[model samples]
Target: MDYLSRTKRQYWIVLFVCFLIYNALIVGLWLLLHSLGSHFHVANDIALLICSVFGLLLMIVFSSIISKYLIEPLKAIWQLILHISPSGVAVPAPNIDSLKTGRELVANLAMQVYQLTAVAGQYGTKAADSELNNNFVANKLPLPLFILDSGETIIYANIAASDYIGTPVKDLTGKNFYMVMDMSFPSESTLDKWLKDVKANTATASMSWERVRLNVLDNHPTRLFDLAAFYNKDNPQNYETMLVLFDHTKQYSQDDQAVSFVALSVHELRTPLTLLRGYIEAFEEELGNEMNPDLKDFMQKMGATAQQLNAFVNNILNVARVDNDQLQLSLHEEKWDSIVESAITNIALRAKVRGIKLESHIEPGLPTVGVDRLSIYEVLNNLIDNAIKYSNDSKVIKIDAHLTHEGMIETTVQDFGVGISPNIMSNLFTKFYRDHRNRSQIGGTGLGLYLSKAIVSAHGGNIWVRSTLGQGSIFGFTLKPYTMLAEEIKNSDNKDIVRGAHGWIKNHSLYRR
Candidate 1:
């Protein structure tokens, strides 16, 4: 039998025997009292009173026995364990030697209990110190790191994290992560959105973002870095989320600022470019009758070249504006068809120069669109210009506008060009992005498509592409109707409507001159 069961059975047997003996003693006293009462002719009430007093005295003796044997030992053991210390400084051992009976048992038990407590306390202290040291090292490390609890609040941030974020440790702790970081990405997919998606749908996940820009609201310059996220759904370490940052601001901004400076310089060159174009047009008009055939062709070429330079300058400035987040949209209700016609007229000279014909189609009675005219014009120009640059021995570049069943204005620029590879689609709209293989042969600053995407997105539209190698490519976009987009903004929960699943599905494009 088990130890507890055997001990429990023994206890019952001892209690039953004691109960019988005590009852027998009571019977004996009652018989003795009755005999005395009869022999001495004592009153029945006096005999009963003597019996009651004896019963009360027996209870007091039983209580004294319990206190000395059971209660006293238990109290001494508790105090023994309490006074024992890991440092080996001992207190008086409860004076168990005074118990007189089983003094050896109580002393031995106290010694055993004290030994167990001393051992446990030492190991516990060591483990606690190790954990404390680990935390101290993490806080002092120069690498930026932080931990987040299940609530997405910042539970802990290292010193480096506080320095990188320009916030103090006390200020950062307990704050929601999304509130502190004003983040933007080259793609619509962000760190926070990915975190939510992983939490709801997966057991564990890891995600990283490259060239993640951290926009600072104060005097500090914006920071650029690569961010990595680590997560576990069931973690023993307690924290559910951890993020580490690798600051690459110096390297990334060095290249970007240098390019932005040169691009901004193009803003100054525009006036001279306009004068140059004006003079070229004047020469063509004044000398039209006197010039020979080859000379007239040369004049036409000069004007076309000037127009090309103007387009390049505009692209440079637009790209800089998009990078700096300075591009603002002034959307007006306008005729979608008229916009298309104007685009064709403006880009016709470039198409003629490239030996490519411009073609256009518009579904009749199309609704007006909410758009920024000049930026929309640039979007069209960039798309068609890209088609023209890559139109490998192709003839016609077709642009069409039609109202879709979804009540959005849809447009596509189709070209029989050296079709885009299945790869490189995701990065087509990234700023400063270029396909290295075509760098030598293709001439462009790679800003056209990126600038186009930013503008199209600002207007609450979507851009996408479909391509097959060695055949042709079609770049398409959609614009919500003016009334519908305005209504969406007014009714939007946060007063902003962002493209979620659809916007990130397509790549950005650029102009190649």
Candidate 2:
């Protein structure tokens, strides 16, 4: 930094000296003009005007000369700047001998530049040697390693990476890391998401994650591994974003199987939940006209709680199915109002329990949508349940359904709650991601939005969120109208399923596919 300041100071000093000389010349011209005015008996006003014009022309010409001889020469002092002469740029031959002192200053500045270049060259050599040594060690390591750019595009991959990915490094290079590695993690923060966060937040940092599932792009066997990511370091050009993986499949597979067994055991809780729901339904039926407002609210709360728990159990099972490729959506024609009403009914009680009102409005005459009723029901359940949980002091949650101009049913659930922060919005729908601030205060498994996103996407629809801090959030999703889906099926290849889809984005989610 100081080098730039010193070069700049020398540059200005040259300009200042030339300026002083130019001023003296101007003063000499004024005196010469006064002498002519007196000797030729010309008007003093005319003499002054003539001097002013001459002075302007001289100033312009002088500026051109100084810029060419001095400015461009001095610019070489800082070679790192582009669009200008670099360190090796040739200074004009036959130095400006008329300005001997200026010529010497230029020589001094050039000598300093040469010294700077030599020092930089020595440093570059050392950095190169260090990087070569690091690369040698890295290639010998058992961990699968990859270097990616800011967009997660793989630039280099080691031999272990090729073995792990089931492809040669040459073939994997230049592909998007995410596309090449068809994998997922059970953790809140993923390796890719953490890479982005680190790039934005820090200069030098690394993180390690365990139990990262690695499913190679090709039809290769999936494996579990521990992962590490490094982003934006003061290293060689290609080492900016690097990732390493340690195989842990054999170790984690048994643990995963154990968890699955425990989950199957927990599934038995549904028997008690079924009987509990039956008792609540009996209460609702028997109470008849004798129940007061408070008793009605109590019954509603109990019923909603039981239903909510049932949904969670199903969600866990369905998520497992999704991971195993067993989850499938069988879309059928259903009235928009029918789907909204069923979902709202299930979640309305939960809202009432939290003292929050659900205001639902479906536009009249909207076309029926093509969606799997059970799957979409869960999507709505997750969304509205989230709204109820986060609607801090707000009392009302609005559910709006309308036929978009593009012939899709757009459903939105809005809440005036302590909304999400902008910094954390990108990973809101990713698996197991909960805002740390609310993670302790709130009771959740961090899977609701992720499950909701997966269900909606599997239905060939798009889901997204829009929120402002303290102003609350709006979670919206769009489903194709049954008529349109039928028409498209009749006209085109079935492969082009999702057309003109606004999959998701920052605030608008307006991207089309």
Candidate 3:
């Protein structure tokens, strides 16, 4: 039998034995009283009544002693044991002073047992408290965090995650991660492949999704989130995975709206600027020889200013297109010399106005490149223009092109200018970022380099700048060389087949020319 049940049975047996002894003492006293009454000639009724009263008084006294010395102390000890049980309650220590010596020994033994049990349970209580603290911290965090078991089952989710998923925390537990997320990918196997790559440690365990709908309910807004997964090393054989999510929905929306507004406003301003430039060019063309030299120069300056404004507008439009993923390119095989000449000719007027000499060095027999000709021309123009603006007292600007050992064409535009500082260089190509030191000294919309970087990246290349603060700066980019394969395709008579085979060769081009 269990300890509680055996103890209860023993208690009942003790009570029964006490009852029998009390009754035997009462019966013996009554018999003796009756015999004394008969010897002393007293009434039998009076003797019986007296014996009954004495028996009742004796029972009451014995009951009070048992309850005070035994029952009450035992009850308190039993309550203390229950309090220290796994149920996590607290009870006051029992008072053993009211008990007689032998009963007090039993009470002390019970108290010792309670103390030992409390010591044994201390570690478990601490562990429980630690877990409670961890959960509290996780739930209080702003970002959503989830803990998954070895089977990719979500064992725990923070309050933010539960709110994001539109489910209660208890309901979310035991759900599979993929089912809870309900991710959509380009192809059916894309998610599987990504998971496999993450598990195999062949790819980064972080990913982002645009316009991800967290809830299955209709009309739910989509959000962008950066999700990262990491293995929990606490258990080696059955490790857990921690998933964290950061929301970027509001930021992306604000950026999109800002870019659209700038693009629209700049597009509207371009029309009047174009008309002003046309009028200036017409006036110069009609009265150039007959007009005074100063007047001619004034007209020329007006034209240059107009052209600069138009270029800034174009940069703004290009930035918007790139941000919206609407920049389309018409790629073709073009000779490096022809592309370079066109870019130089376009920027020659600006370079001459700044008194900065333009120089070029092209390695002989440099292979033709597959690129969007006009886009590359814009890149070169922006770099040279930037060089001319920053060249405080320097006069020489060099443009060099050569074939790299990796079979790619590398082009560099070096200028003897007030070079960029290390702090500004890193953020030079970020959209809408202006160098605080040069913003007042030089006039620019800060989108030129950003557009250049975007154009180069679209051509499957990279662009970077190197500079020493007082010396000079060099801007360089690499492009894939046009191969015999491109030549064969260009020479082929099957135009329809070429159009069908290549997706990048679409004719509905929207990019700046």
Q: Rank the candidates by TM-score, best first.
A: 3, 1, 2
lDDT of 2 by residue, 323-385 (tens): 667677656556778768867876777887888999999999998787666788788888999
The CA lDDT at 389 in model 3 is: 86
Name the runs in model 1 displaced over 4 angstroms. Answer: 1-264, 487-513
Instruction: Summarize candidate 3's per-residue lDDT along 1-513 as a digit string, tens digits.
Output: 354454455566667877888888888987887778778987878877887898889789878855654566467667656744666776755555554323444454565764465355433442242342244346667888887776788877888988876778878888988788775543343444555666676423555434443435565666656565665434332325777888866886686677769866986897799799889988988988998977876787777678777777777777778888888765676677777866787677677766679999999999988776767777887888888888889999999999888888999999888888998888999888887888889988788899999999988888989999989899999888878337644764433321211133445333222
- lDDT of candidate 1 over 1-513, digit per residue (tens): 353354355445655655676677777888998998888988888878877888778667755654454455567766665555444556655777665334566566665654454345334442232332235345656788887888888877888999998999889878998787778887998887888899999978988999999989879988999999998877544467889999999999997887768666885787788798889888888989999988987777777778777787878777777777778765655678877887788788878877789989999999988776678888988898888887879999999999888889999999997787888878888877776766887778788888889888988899998998878889988997888767644553422322111121112221110
Lowest-scoring 10 consecutive residues by lDDT in candidate 2? Answer: 495-504
What lDDT score goes with residue 448 in model 3? Answer: 86
lDDT of all the models against the reference?
0.76, 0.74, 0.72
Model 3 alpha-carbon drift over 4 Å, by segment: 1-263, 484-513
Question: What ranking of all candidate models by lDDT puts the best one first?
Answer: 1, 2, 3
